[model samples]
Target: MYYIVMNMNCEDCGRYIPHSVYKYIGFCEEQGKVVFNEPPTNCDTVSKTTMDSLSSVFGSLGWVYCIDCKAPIFEMEEAVKHIASHHLITTRFMYDSVAAEEVGAVS
Candidate 1:
């Protein structure tokens, strides 16, 4: 259940930016590109993945946050399953309803 807390700005409830994806160079949503040495500010929005320097040594260095469950997941496969089963179905249903409305309007 341990995770590597990140030190950068990010979108809150940032969907599924697997912490493993960003190994180095934190992303600044404002800048819209990967940059280095940005003064680490309120990392509340970061993906909250895993580890700093020593994490590699200890090997607790891979994790991703789940917005709906509000927890850290250690494996990508498990994360995919979780999102697919828990979130995508609801999203698909909502999109289908909206699509129906759009079709009705068009007709």
Candidate 2:
């Protein structure tokens, strides 16, 4: 298995992110423009279908998170299959039950 390590600080919160949660980081330069993005460790997850529906909206960014508190951030655009990933769901189920609150069907 391969793991990604991010050496950048969280934009929302000023804190050092551990290598464990680092997903992937990339940098792009076009003409005189430069863009750098590092997807966060904690972000919302959604069903596969939802991802396809929102793919156009999400574009390239994956997940969002808070570096200081390690809080989960949400990206409404890319929630489909991304949410079902074992790494994310299992982590929420084991540590926080609040995540499951959104899984139930409402009356």
Q: Pick the candidate with the highest lDDT.
A: 1
* lDDT tens per residue, model 1, 3-38: 423433332213222222232233345445544434
Question: What TM-score against the true fold does each predicted structure earn?
Answer: 0.26, 0.17
The lDDT of each candidate is 0.37, 0.29
Poorest lDDT segment (10 consecutive residues) of candidate 1:
88-97
- Which one wins on TM-score? 1
* lDDT score at residue 5, model 1, on the 0-100 scale: 30
* Candidate 2 per-residue C-alpha lDDT over 1-107 given as tens digits, one digit per residue, 9 for 90 to 100: 21222332222111222221232221121112222233334422211223343343345454433322345435643233333332221111112235457458767
Q: Which TM-score value belongs to model 2?
A: 0.17
Which pairs clash (backbone N, Cα, C closer than 3 Å) in model 2?
Answer: 45-83, 46-79, 46-80, 46-83, 47-80, 47-81, 48-81, 51-80
